[model samples]
Target: MKVSKLAVKILENESVVYYDPIYHGRTLKVIGIDDDPVEVMEYLLAQYKEKGYSIVVFDTSGHFPTGLFESVLRIEEGNPAGLDPLKMARMGIIKDPYSAVTIVQTIYELDSASTDKLYADFVTGKVNSIADAVKAKKNYSEIILEGYTDLDEMLFSGDPVRIPESGLIDLSGLNSVTLTGMAFLILAAAMEERRRVVYGLYDIAVLTFTGAGNAGLPLLTRPARRRVAILGTKYPLDQVLSIPGPTLLLYNDPDVQSAIYESQGVPAGLRAFIDKGEGAYIWRSPETINVEFGKVLKLQP
Candidate 1:
C-alpha cells in the first residue's frame, strides 16, 4: 500500500500484541480505536499526559498529510470549550472583564489598520497594557504581538506580492514544514488549554541529536513529563538512531530493517518479525533483545 494509505490503515485498524518469551511465551493484545487520526493522536497524548507513556513518535516520513491539521481544527471547532474570555479571566490571564475586552479591542485595532506604521504603532501602545494583564513570568502576548508585527513588516515590507486566496494559510510560497510547524503551534495551544493534551512533531535528526535542548523546542521537557513527540521523516537508521526513549517504527521499509539489524547486530530471523505485512516494529533501545513484532487486527468498517 501507499505510505499515506498505510498510515490511515494503522490508525484505523492497528493494535499492538505483546509477547514475553520468558513466561511460557504468553501474548497479549491491546485493542484500541478512535474516531480519527486526531483523536487517536489525542488519546496517545493523553496516555503521555496521564498514563506516563512519556514520548510517542509516529515518524510519518514527512509525507505527514496536510489535511490532518485541518481535521484537528474541525474537531476543535465542533467543541466549544477552548480559550474563552471568561476562562482567561478565571485563569488570571486578565485582570478583569474589561481587560479581556481590551485584548480583543487591541487585536481589532491592530487588524483594522490600513497602513503598516499604524499597525506597528497600535502594538507598541498596547504592549505595556497586555504585559501588565498577563500574570505569567514571561509575557507571551507581548512577544507574539511584537514578533508578529515584526514578521508582518518583513513579509509585507517589500512591494506586496499578490497572494492567491487559497486556504487559511497561503501555501503558494511557504514550505510544507513551515506550514506544519505553524499549524501545530496554533492547534497545540488550543488543545493544551481545552483538553490538556500536548502534541508536537519534529525532525528525527534534531530530536535524536539535540533532544530537548533545541531552542524553541515544542515538546515539554521530560520532567514536565507529559508530551508526545511524533518525528516524521524519510531518513535512514544512521540518521534517525539517537532518539532518547523507546520508539515505535511504523513503516515496513527494507532499508530501515536492514539498517536496524546492521546497527544492532541482531540475528537474520529478526527480519521475519520486523517485516510483518501490516504492523509496526517496536524497538525499546539499541539492544538486540528489546524488539517485538505485532499487527493491527482488521476490523469491520
Candidate 2:
C-alpha cells in the first residue's frame, strides 16, 4: 500500500474517513496474526524518518533492516565495537544506575554481595571494565570472564560507544537475559544523551522494538522528556493494552481478537464480520475504528 494510505482511515461507513497522522509520542502496538508485523513497522519507520523523527530500535529479530537507520550497533561475537557498560557508567552517561546494576547482576548471576561490590566500584570509578573488576576479585573472575568471552572487547573494554540520534541496536543471537541487559544499557545511554541535548520543542523520538517480547518490557517503561512514538510487536497483548496509548492491532488469534473487540466496545455480532474483513482495528481514546494499513515495503538491504 502507498504511504498515503495510513494518513486516513474509513470509519464505520465507507464514505466516512478520519484523518490519523499516527503522530509522534503516541504509543502504538501493532500485533499481527498470520502477517509479518515487522513489515508494517519498517513502513512506519520510513515515514517517521521522512518527517525528521530520530529512530532508535532495539531488535531481537536479526532480520530487521539496518540500512534504514544512519547508525547500526550489532551485538555479536568479535564485533569489537558496541556499547560499553563500564565506560558509560564512568562517563556519567548512564542515567539509571540501579537499572544498570540490575543488568549486570542478571547477566553474571552475581550474588548480592558481589553485586554490591560491583555497584560500588562502578560508582567510585575504581573499575573501568569488566576485566578490571574480574581482576579485582578472584571469586567473580570465572563467571564474568566466561559470560563475556563471545562479546566484542569494546563492550567490556575500550572507550564508550556513542549513542546515535538514529540507529538500530541488533541484539539478536544472544540469550534473553543478555539481550535485556544490553538493551537497558543502550537505552539508558540514549535517553541520557537525549535529555542532555534537548533537540526541540516538537522533536520526536521513535523507539521501535521487534521480537523483543518480555525482554523489551523494561526498556519500554523508561520515562522520557521529549515526544516519543513507542512501537512494539510480539509483545503480550494485555501488557500493551495496559500502557495507556493508542493501539493499532492487526489480525490476531480469536482470543486476542475477541479481547480487543470487547475492549473497544465493538458489538459482539460485528466482531466476526470485522475479523473476516480486510484492514486492521485502531483503538484511539473514546472509540475504535477499522482502518487499512499501508502496504509493507520490500525488505531493505
Candidate 3:
C-alpha cells in the first residue's frame, strides 16, 4: 500500500492526516460514480478509504465524503466555510441547499463532458450539485490595479486572477505585509462592484499588524470580476515606508532620505486622495494602470 497525506488549509486547526496503504500497489477498484461534484468528491473519499490509496487529497470544498468512504481515514476538505454566513450563502451550500444526493447526480454529466477536453477543474458548493458550487468564491474578472514595475504589470495585464470576496488573500509574492489589509479591501471593493469603496476601519486593518484597531471592516458579499496588482516595494523609490496609503504614497517627503532625483516611487501628486488615513487606492478607470513613481512597460508592446 502506498500512503499519502491530506491538508486542511481552511480548517482553523490546520490538521494533517495520513492513511496507511495510500495505494494498494496494484489498482484496487476506485470509481467516482456520484454525479454531484460534492457527493462525487465524498464518494471518492469513501472509495479511497475503502480501497486505501497510497496518497489522497479530497480536492473539494469543505465536505467530508460519506458512505463508501465511511471507514476511510486521512482525507480532508479545504475551503472550510468561515463563521460568516454570506460566504456560506454564496456557495448556495447552507444546510438545506447543499446536499449529497443532488451533487452526485450532477458530476456524472460534467465528468462525461470533461472526459476528453483540455480543461481545468474546480469544486463548488452550488445549490444544485456538489461540483457546481466548488470555488463559488472564485469569480475572475480583468482587474487592473496600480502596477509599479515592468514584469509585474505584464503579469496582471496578461492573465485573469481571482479575487476572493474574503479569506486569507495571499499577496505575499506581490507586496509588503503592511498592504495585506488594503489588498483584501481593494478586492472587496471590486467584489462589491463598487465604482469606489469608502474603506472603513476594519477594511483598513486588513493588513495592519496584530493589535491594530480594525473592527470596522465591511464584509460585503457581492459578485466579483477582475485582476490585481499592488505597488510599493516593487517600484523604484517607493515611499511605502513613509507617506502611507498602500505604503507607496509616502515618497518625496522632506524627511525621505532617498537620494536626490528620486521620486521615492510615491508619486507625491497623488497624495490629495489619501484621505488623511494613509490609505492609497488604485481601482478606478479603464485598463490603464499608472503611478508616477513607476513607468509602465507594455506587456506586449
Candidate 4:
C-alpha cells in the first residue's frame, strides 16, 4: 500500500487514546503499530505537509533515512565540545581576534614541524586537533592563551553548544538529558527563524534521566504544528503517556509492550507476520492491520 494510505489509517483511528486515565483527557496520546514504521512516519509527515500542516520528527534512534532531509544537525562523539571548531565557526560563535588567538596559540602549542600543515588544515575545515589543544590549554604547561577579545569567553569556554540549521539532526553520543535539551534549543530556534524542520534524535533513553520528570515529557505536552515521532524499543509509560499525539511502535517486542502496559496501563498490540516480503500483520492496538514494508529503490553511485 502507498504511504499516504498508512497515514490515513493512523489518523483515522479515533479509538486511539491520547489521554491517560489519571490525567482525565487533559493530554494527548495514541499508539500505532507497524513494521518498518519509519517509512510509515515519513509518508504520514508528507501527507500532513501536503495539506499545509507542519511536522517534526524526533528520531531517538538515529536510524532514519539521512538523504530525505534538507539540512542536518549532528551531535555525537565525532564532534565533541573541544574538538569541533569548524562547527563553532559555522554557527558564528567564533570570530575575529578571539578566533585568531585561539588558532595561533594552538598552532604554537603543537610541535613546530607540523604547525603550517595543521594551520592549513584548520583553515580548510580539515582538522580540529589544534582547536582541541587550544581548548585544553590548562593541561599543557607550555601553551598559554594570552590575548583577550570581546568574544573571549565564547572561544575559550570549550562548550560546543551550537544551534544547527533546520534539517535532519543526529544527536548520537550525548547523554539523554543533553540530547533533549539540545533538541529543544534547536527546535525553538527553528520556530523563531520560521524554518521548516524534520529532526531526529537517536537513543531517547537519555531524555528520561528522572523517570516521569524527564525533560522530553514537557516537549511532548506542548502544542505545535510539528508531528514528533519518538522511536525506541522501550519508553517509560509516563514519558509515553505525555506524548500529545500519535505514538508509533515499529517493533512489537514483549519487553517494550510490557513496559508500556506496566507503566501506563495501556495495551500495545502484539506483532504478527502474516506474509513475507509483501507485508506483515500488526494486531492488537485498537484493531488488527496489515502493513507494507519499505524497500530500497536504488543504490547510490
Q: Which is the leading candidate under TM-score?
A: 2
Candidate 1 Cα misplacement greater than 4 A, ranges: 1-71, 74-227, 230-240, 261-273, 285-289, 297-300
Tens digit of per-residue lDDT, candidate 3, span 82-141: 212123223432232222221221212234333222122222322222223332232211
Q: List residue ranges in candidate 2 displaced over 4 A.
A: 1-25, 95-99, 109-116, 138-158, 173-177, 180-185, 192-216, 220-225, 234-244, 253-256, 259-277, 282-301
| Per-prediction tally of clashes | 2, 2, 44, 11
Instruction: Give the lowest summed-lDDT range of ten residues in model 2.
Output: 196-205
Error of 4 at 75 (Å): 1.9
Listed per candidate, the RMSD to the true structure in angstroms reads 13.3, 7.0, 24.2, 13.1
TM-score-better candidate, 2 vs 3: 2
Q: Residue 60 in model 2: shift from native, Å?
A: 2.0
- Model 4 per-residue lDDT at 149: 26
Prediction 4 TM-score vs. true: 0.43
In candidate 1, position 231 carries an lDDT of 36
> Which residue window of length 10 is worst by lDDT in model 3?
24-33
Count of clashes in candidate 3: 44
Model 1 whole-model lDDT (C-alpha atoms): 0.32
Per lDDT, what order, best first? 2, 4, 1, 3
Q: Comparing 1 and 4 by TM-score, which wins?
A: 4
- Number of the top candidate by lDDT? 2
Tell me the TM-score of each prediction against the true structure: 0.38, 0.65, 0.19, 0.43
Give the alpha carbon lDDT tens digit for every residue of 1-301 in model 4. 2132113333222232121112121122323333244554454445435655434444546666665556656555323433233444444544432343333433234344445444455566555533453454333313424432223323224554544443555544444443344334333322332323332333344455542224334434443333333333234446554444333333445565455444443333433322212222122234433222322112233
